[model samples]
Every structure is written in C-alpha cells, then in structure tokens.
Target: MTKNTTINYREKIEHSHVYDVAKITPLEFQPNLSARINNRVLLKREDMQPVFSFKLRGAYNKMASLPTDTLKRGVIAASAGNHAQGVAMSAQKLGCRAVIVMPTTTPLIKINAVKARGAEVILFGDSYSDAYVKALELEKSEQLTFVHPYDDPDVIAGQGTIALEILNAHPEPIEAIFCCVGGGGLLAGIAAYVKAVRPEIKIIGVEAKDAEAMTESLKQGKRVMLDQVGLFADGAAVKQVGEHTFALSQQYVDEMIVVDNDAICAAIKDVFEDTRSILEPAGALATAGLKEYAKRNNLSGKTLVGIASGANMNFDRLRFIAERAEVGEKREAVLAVTIPEKPGAFKTFCRLLGDRNITEFNYRYSDPKEAHIFVGVAIADPNESANLVADLIAQGLPALDLTDNEVAKLHLRHLVGGHAPQAENEVVFRFEFPEKPGALMKFLDTMGHDWNISLFHYRNHGADFGRVLVGMQVPPNEQTEFAEFLQNLGYPHWDETHNPAYKLFLG
Candidate 1:
C-alpha cells in the first residue's frame, strides 16, 4: 500500500513484455450504450484477446520475463478457468513445458483447449483451492517454476499495461474507469497505473455482491476470506483476493460497486445490443457496475469506461441469461396476485392490465374462494412495478411483487400448483452447492432419512453451482435438531417457509 510499491508497479508496467504475446485491444466508443445512458461510454475490448480474456497479458509477461535456464525446467500453474488457458497459450508461444492443474469438474472443452496449446493437463480434486495444493506439491517434486495467477509482482505489472493502454487511447477528460475484480489482478493493475499517472481520474472496481472479496477486504481494512462464493459469475468468483493485488487495491482503487447476477445478465445483453458480441457473466461485470453507478449518481455529459474482460461464455447458459435479462433491465416485473375465484374474475384481472403486455402468466385452482396467479408484465420504467402493484391493491386484488425474490424467479414461476393439504409442518428451504457428479446424492445422503422431503425443484443454468428448492416435513418437536442438521450440511441455504410466493401457490 505504500507509495513506493505503486511507483514500482507503474515502472514495471511501463516496460512490460506483455505485447510480446498479447495484442493491443481497442477502446471503442459504444454509441448505443452512450445514447441510452445519456453519457459517453467506452468499452475496452479485452474479450478480443487471443485467449479471449485479459489473463494472457499477465500470464505471458510473467513467463516471457523468466530466465532461459528456468524456462527450460518448465512451469506449473493451477486454475480451472481463463488463467489456465492464458498460461497454456503463453507456454506454447515461449516453447516451454507447462503443466496446468485443474479441477476434475472442469468442462471438457476447457481441458481440450489447454491440451490443444500443447500444455500437459492434470485434473485433480474438486475445486481451484484443491488443485492449487496439488500444483504446489508438483512444483516442489518436479522442480518446476510456479506461476502465481495474480499474486506475483510480475503478473500484476503485466496486467497494469491495460491502464496504460486505456489512457493512451482516450486523452480527453474522463469521469471514471471501471474494472472487474476477481483475485484483484485486473482491477489492482489498472488502479496502480491510473493512480500513479492520472491521479485526477477515478478508478473503480466491480464485484458480484455474492463474491465481493475485494469490497469486503477494503471495508474490513484487511483481506477477508469468504465461506462460499456464488458461481454465476464464476470468472470473478474468488474467496480471497491476492496479497499483492489486495495491497495495491487498498491504496489505489477509488471506489467499489457490488452488483447481482440479474444486473450481469442485463449487461451482457447491453453489450450484445451495442456491438453484437456476447460476453460471459464476469466479462459483463464492469458494464453492469457502470450502469448502476451512473444511475445512482445521476451524472451525465462525462465519459465513462468499462472493461469487457472476456467472452468465454457457455452456450447452454443463454436461455437462463435471456430469461433474467428483462428483470435485470427493469423491463419486466414478476408478481403474485390474489383474486376471487368466482366466474369472470380472470377476465377482470386481464382487463386491469389495460394494454400492458403480459410477458408470462400462470394460474392454478388452489382454493374455492380465492385464486392466486403468477404473472410477468413488461414495463419501460423501473418504478412502474410498484405503481402497478399499488393499483392492483386499490382495485381490491392483493398483489405481491416477486421481481426481487430469488426463490420466485428461480423456481416459483415454473411451479404453480395447488396447496399440499396433507403435508404437515413443511418448511421450504433453498440451497446451493458446487455442481459435480454425485452432488445431489451427497445432499440426500446427508439428509439421512431425518426428515421427509415433500417437494423439490431443480434446474441447471450451466453454471458451476446447482440450486435446489426443497420442502421438508419436520415435526415441531425436532425443529432444534433440524436447525443443527442444516448448520452442518456445508451448503449455503435460505429459509423460505414463510415466503409469500410459497404461501400463495404451494404452501
């Protein structure tokens, strides 16, 4: 965090050899995004890199600067994502033997990509941390040089070249430069160069709200490890930021913004609309943060820049992203409305919509006296959802907004069923765990016949994690024991027993 460290990093970036293997990505102005937000928006196209990510800059620079004798001995690194590809390609370019340790759960496409670059791929363990431990052991046993993904000085300096490029591309007055934070390599590198050179320009970092290690670290005045991270933005999901990156970010980053998965999906769509290019969740992170920051501050007429970090998107995820983008963009509202079950009530409900397009509607006959419906309505303004809910209430129809409810958006809309009258003492809970073979079986085995499962729902979104909503029937006397069971289950969970959406449709 010292000024001396900042100067050292800036100097290293100024003379980095990243350009030996990494290309100079363009900083193109986004006209569509600019006009829509009423501010000039520029995108740093790192997604166009040879490895389809900015990771190559750091990985190559670190390897290219190594001593020839050391390179002959080979190198090793552990990563399950973009970093692995960066190292593989860099090693191929440098003609050095490279060994990459990746999780066993990594996709075959990624494994093949690394092997195609002539690097040796070793799949071990079930997560990055486990693979990292294996890599360390191999490094010592095989006497190979280890490449620390984001923690090393050389790597940080190489990543800093991005900031230098951004400044040279746009010399005009700028409002802020947004960078997405994972292990803090990208953001820390950008912040170091910007703060050292363009002190007047703001340097902001963006992170998923569920995986905000840097944000939490800066707030706590130290690096804090998270118990778990949401895997939707897996590219930027880090339990802890790197030591060097954390120190630099602590002193250089001006501000940090946290956004959710919905916002990320919307940002992906935003970029697609502007440039006809699709970005992965982490790649669109800074764009999402930029939109939120601009709206929150109400600033306009100034230039803003966002890093489109990568585009290694999974094809299977497009459907889920498309479904959530509308909600994220405030273009759609999901609601639960109750009305009299008498004849013509359904017609009255449609009449109340009054030309407002219904994106989706689901109803099930639950009670003789009342009816509950799940609905999705299109809206141009974000405030229109609250207004519509109020109007529905005024008309004597009770309405609850499920636009912000994770449970409702993820599962409830697909499950509109009559209440389970015979299911007694049922408690609904949502859970997330790393997706892998036998994961669900492990969950079931952990339950161990302690409670009967009344209802269950799960759908894959092509993410590293799996989400499940379960209703369990636990006797009142065993509530304390059930609490202990959940505590020891080792999965992130939320109690949704009293959730309004659950009560209306399936309680």
Candidate 2:
C-alpha cells in the first residue's frame, strides 16, 4: 500500500503474537570483531535459528497472526532456498501446511530440508521468479493462502522484531546498524523499528553488486527489474525489491552500499576467522558493508552492529570461495614469467623467487629457436608483487603479472601448456595412477636421472591418470636417453613438444 501504511502495519506486528519469535533469537555481542573494528559489534545470530536464517521470524510471525480459518486453508510460497526452509519450518511449528514451490536448480540439501519439515516441495522453474510464477498458479488451483516473502505488511513487521531484540539486549546507544538487503524486507522492518525508537541510529542497507535490486530501485525512485542476477549469493539474488519494502527503505534507510563478489568473499573469510562460522556470500553482506564504510570514512570508535544473516551455503561452492578469498583480500597474485629455456635457467629463476612461496608453477617450451618458457607463480601479498616484478627484471627475466586480471584467472590458468614446439624426439607420457602413496617417486625411479624434464605440467584432475606432460632437455647428443626412459616407464606415451599448436601457446 503506502509508505505510512506499512509503518501502521509494523505497529500492528508489535501487538501480534511475536513473543514466541523473540524468545528464540537474542542479540549476542562479538567482542573479538568489535575490538578489531574499534567499535562494539553485536551479532544477531539468525543463522542459528531453526531454519538457519532470520526469515523464520517474519514467516512465523505472519502465519501465527493470520486468522485460524485462513491457516487451515494452507499456505504457499516460492523460494529456491532459505525462504522455502523458513516458510516450511514456520508452518510446521504453527501446525499449518506449507506448499513450497522451488526452482529445479535448487540444491538437494535445501529441497530435502523443506520436505523434511512436512512441506510439499514442488520443483518447478529455473529461478526464484519462475518458481513465483508457478506458486501463483498453485494458489489459484488449490485455493491456498499466499505468503509474500518481503512485500507483505506482516512479514515486514515480523522482521522488525529483530530491532526490538537488539535494542533490548544492548541498551547502550548504537551509532549504526548494518543489515543485508535482499527484497528489502529485513532492512525495511529493522529501519522502521530502530529509527522509530532511537531516530539517531543510522540504518545502512548492504547489497551484493551482482544483485543490487533495492539500491538501484531507490536511486531510480521506482522498482527496476534486473535482467539477470548472479546466483552466487542465492539468498539475496532478487531481481526486484518488494513494493512495501521499497517504500519503507526510501523513508527510513539512511544509506545503501553495494559490494562486489570479491569483497563478499573476503568478508566471508573474515567472519570465519573471527567467529569460526561459515557464512554464505549473502550472509556476509552486512560485514562487507561495515568494512567498506569503515575504510571509506576512516571511521573509528563508533558502535556498529552487523547482522550475520544466514549460513546456508552450498558445500560444493566452498572451493570457489577459497579460490576467490585471496584475491578478495589482496593477498594473492598471479604472474606470467618468460625465462630463457637453457640448462640451469629454471634453477636461476627459482633462486630469484626469494622466500616467496610458489602456490602454482607451470612451464613449457614453446619454440626451439627462441628457447623461452612461460611460467605462472602465485605470490603472497599485492605490495610484494610489484617488488617481485622488479626482481625478475633485475635478474634479466621478463614477467607479466595478471593477478588482477579476471580473464587470466578463469580461462588462462587452465589453458596453459597446449602450445609448444613439437620436438620429433620429445616424448609425451601419461602416468596412470592415483595421486597418492609415492606415485611420483615410482615414475621418477623409472628415469633414474638419465633424462632431464624440459617441459612438465601436472594438474590433479581427480581421475585415475595423473597426466604429466614432460619434455626432457635432450641435447642433440642425448636424444636416445628419453626414448629408453619412456620404454622403461611402461605408460602410454606420445611426443607432442614439437607440435605447432604447442609452439604458439607455450612460446
């Protein structure tokens, strides 16, 4: 309805049956993070709730206040993940039936969670909006009551209870509150309650840059539907903010901050280091906002509370998280080095590395005439990276650092050794064995130091074969040394170091 109308509804939510909801979630102070940020940090551990998110607070509060006869008709909601679990768990707790329509792409863990909560989970759609469309169809067909995720007045009010708990727990003056904004329901509710009680306390909404629906909407003074959203932060990957939530956000929200994926990844790592809790990208939004704000304003000695929203991360996504965390924190760098392909050339390059541990090293001979090799190294610090480049230059080696380059990280890292000079005498061998129990030692024993590996590329591909693309530095004098070595190895072999394509890529 109207902006003021939602505030009125929020007041009604205070008088509704919300006592049970508040009893379940209470604000807890995080002294460690507070000390680091030079402010008092309190976490509302909504992730520890029954549904592993704060969504249950609004869902339960809304469903509990509905008329008994309406509840008997059953409820329907569309969500691919957290919201589905929240609605299912809340309905089960209230002795009501919930039919959840989720996207087919939703993880099995989430789908099974909804079904385990006694909700009928219908997998239909490729995204949340698609599921929402299907949910509306089901509501019409089954005569079920629809529970809007964030737009409804009751849901907003239920989320407002979070503000009440925070104030009650920390009676001391709070300077600012950082909360993640998805459809803007959480921000809308908390902003209304906190601003009403202590008008001076600033309410800041944090959103992922990839899914900045509310921030873009507020800037345009109307809802703007995003064409596509990044699904990494699934909890907040909403295309548009709810009408009611958007209105309240416009009225009470003081500032909106958008953070990139890398910042969120860094924040996730920060939370884990401080609290030992694994937060999904969306869950780390508020903390990311706080860090960004602090860095921007040079703020210190202000009481800041960041809501650690939820922890429902997909297990399979952890690898991506780990890979991105270093870049996010500016702790890792990727470099490409060109070195003279000669005897002891690699040894000289290795000496120049100078205490910087190599996270990754790859090299291949591209051209026999040029005799240059391409190598990738991962460094520890961004500041040290520049120093490393200078060191390589002084040592007469040329290097191109691509640590900040996105394309290099995604594609170039994997497509490294394809191009090199095809040596008719070069031997290409595929070692078949698990990456365990001295497999490399066995392969090395077969050669007995007779052959020097000119080009070596080994990546553990989670397969039976540990493919080693080896090019022995066979002098014109020792061409037969490699042939004998390959015959004794007893593995599939092919010579590709002399391939024309190999020359282009590796050179």
Candidate 3:
C-alpha cells in the first residue's frame, strides 16, 4: 500500500521483458503552453509511441513476459480501440496470435488497425464490458492467454517507464504530474515510480465525470459498476478500475479530478492549439485537469507535466467535436424563439438578431395564417444569450431559451429548415415520414396542392421516421376545411396551433 512498496514493483516492471521491447523517448517541454500557464508545462508525448498511445508499452510488456507455452497458446484482449491495436501489434511482433474483441460501435479505423496487426478482430456488443465478456469467452474456447489492457502488473509497470523517462528528460523539481485515469493502470504505474523517487512531487489523476469509475470506486471503498458510460471519450470509458491498480492509486495518487465532457472538449482544443495535435478526449483529460488545478489554486510558476496519452481520434467524430467545442468553451448558445410568421416578420427578426453572428438558424411554419415560427439561434457568448433572449422578449417576440436543452442540442439543431411561402387559401399540415427515398416526393404528390403549399420543412433523419414541420396558408379561415383535408391525407396530424408547448417551441 505504501509508495515505496509500489516503486519496488515498478522497478521490476522496468526490468520486465515488455519494457525492454519498446524504445524509450524524452518528455519534451512545451514552451508555448508553459508561457500561457505561467509555468513550465512539459508534455510526456506517449501519443508519439508506436500505435499512437501509451497502451502499446503495457501491451508489448505483457506479451513479451508471457511464458513460452503461453505464447504458443496466443492472447486475447478487449478494448474500445487503443488497447486492441496495442495488443494486436505487440502479439504479432512477438510471433503470437492475438484475438481482439471490440464494441460493434467502435470506429472502422480501429478495427482495421487491429486486423492490420495480424490479430483476429471480432466485433460484438455495445460497450467495453460487453466486448470483454465475448473476449473472455474466446479465451476459454481458444485456450489463449488474456492480455489485459491495464489490470495486470506488467502492464502497469510498462506504463510506469513513462515516469522514468519524464524525470530523466527534465531535471527540474516537479511540482505535479497530471495523468488521465480510466482503470488506473497509467496512473498507478506513473504515481508509484514518481512518488517513490520524489515524494514531494504531487500526482493527480483525471477522469471524465461521466465515466469516473476509479473516482467512484475510491469513494465507495469498493469497485462500483457504472450503468452507463459516455463514449465521447472512448479511450477512457472503463466501468471499473483493476484491483491492483486501484490499490496503487490509493497509495500514491495525491488527488482525483473529475472533468465534464465540455471541459474535455475545451482541453482537446487547447492541446491542439498548443501542440498542433488532435488528442482524443481521454488524452486531453490530463491537460483539462491542469487547467482546473491552475484556476482553482491560482498557482503560477510551478513546473508540471501533462500526459498526452493518445491521438487515435476517429475522423468522422471531428464534426461532433467541432460542434461541441463552441459550447464547451462557452463561445456559443442555442436558443428557441417564437416569431410572427407574416411578411417582414423574419426580416424584422433578422434585424433584431443584430450583430450577434448566427452560428445556426432553423425555422418552420405550422399555421396557414403563418402566425408563428420556431427558431434556434447561436450566440457569441453565454452571457450574451440571456440579453438576446430578453431583447427578443422586449420586441414582443415569445421565446423560450433552450441553450442548455439536451434534446435540442442532440436532435433538433441540425433538423431545422429553411423558410418557404404559403398561399392565402392553402391548408397547413405537419407530417412525419420515414427518412427514405421518395418519401418527401410521395407526400407532396399525395397532397396534390389543390391547396397551394404555404410552408414546408422536411428533413431526412437517419432513422426510420422523419419529422417534418409544415405550414399552408389556407384561404383566410378554413380551419375546419383544412382538418378535413388532413384527415383525408391519412398521415398522423397534430393541431399544434394552440398547444403551449407548441407556442413556446413554435409560436
């Protein structure tokens, strides 16, 4: 349980066959980051390792130390991405077969990486634990050794070499070392060595709040199972910490900092700005923790090292990451507004929008009279959002602020539509259809425009159903007639003209 005790184990880890297998690198000081933080901020660029992660060290170490008989038996491991690649690559290099199990939702890039390394890649389940179960099953069936990603002593010790490299590369008296923790292997390894070598050097562990298994486990004094994990940071989305690693963490780690998804996004941006490298959310955790620590303690001029653990971000995920970045940095806000739908209403609304740059705009009409429109606007700052809302209300515009609504953020943002005109005697009807080919055209053909189309907004959802918000200008007071036409059209229709939720949302 003591620091020295963990160090003794780390010493053995350093001498292990795994450590001997991988090349050692220097921990470079980041002057730009240091100047900004008013401290010497060094980065332990484990991301620069083969397979682009620190996971390779541990996986290689574990594979190298396996008994000759065990090597013949092969190895099996489960991971969302990084560990799978590491183990696969290491096992292949060591002349052993590897079977890798990953969530079906894992990016294709990661799956291909494992396969490229000569590992048998199996896609199963929706989460790491589910994948773990399948891997365990394969292990028994094939009689292969389980090469754990972070739970094993050899893995932790292999990761511990990072600390040795950092200390040797930088001769300064270190104030703190911030590391990202998932199942605690990285933290366990680094903290053990650093705390033993320099007892005064603080070791802080960082975890995403949504997946802080180690933090929750330490609090409960037992490993706690998480019902769900936020996969935005797939690399560190562990449900539980390893027993041995957790014990080491409890003994050597000085503090545990949990950051939210927003902060992690902001940190990703920060690291990219500082190092011009795109770090996965898990990789950014350590930098995020340092930001939090600096702000909380008002500490300046202290030397610190933040581990940029990995950079295996999927290309497709960059869009979502960019969208979330503004909100993460408090640079954008999402708003809902109900504006009069008559002529000049939108133009007036635009004028009222003023100089606040619109990041996004979506609106649809549901009443033939064009009495109201639901709109979402993006603002420049969080503080400006309230003022904008207040200003809109002052203009007699009914608006509901949904800047923080989860549903609005995830489902509604991209579903917004462009404005269209309606006829005086046309009837307005809203319809939801499956987002498939010919769906919209079929709906339009069915309507047949005996009543001219007033307003129409149809968007394709990647799902089975597509929701369309529409409006038709029925001849000045043909409510009953429009109802009959909608009934004849045979699509589910809702009269949202007077609903309060409708009023607030689409007034």
Best by TM-score: 1
Give TM-scores for every candidate, taking all chains together and pairing residue i with residue i: 0.97, 0.77, 0.75
Question: Which candidate order results from sorting by TM-score in descending order?
Answer: 1, 2, 3
| lDDT values, one for every candidate | 0.91, 0.75, 0.74
Clashing pairs in 1: none
After superposition, the stretches of candidate 1 with alpha carbons farther than 4 Å from their true spots are 1-7
Per-residue accuracy of model 2 over 24-116 as CA lDDT, tens digit each: 465767676667667666777777776778888778778887899999989999997777887888788788889999877566788898999
Candidate 3 global lDDT? 0.74
Instruction: Give candidates' CA RMSD values in order.
Output: 1.4, 12.1, 9.2
Q: Summarize candidate 3's per-residue lDDT along 242-302 as a digit string, tens digits.
A: 8888888878888889987777877788777777889888888998898788767888999
Give candidate 3 regions above 4 Å deviation.
1-7, 16-21, 25-40, 338-354, 366-401, 417-507
User: Pick by lDDT: which candidate is best?
Assistant: 1
> Model 1: per-residue lDDT, tens digit, 399-445?
99999999899999888965898999999999996678887787787
Cα displacement (angstroms), candidate 2, residue 408, comes to 2.9
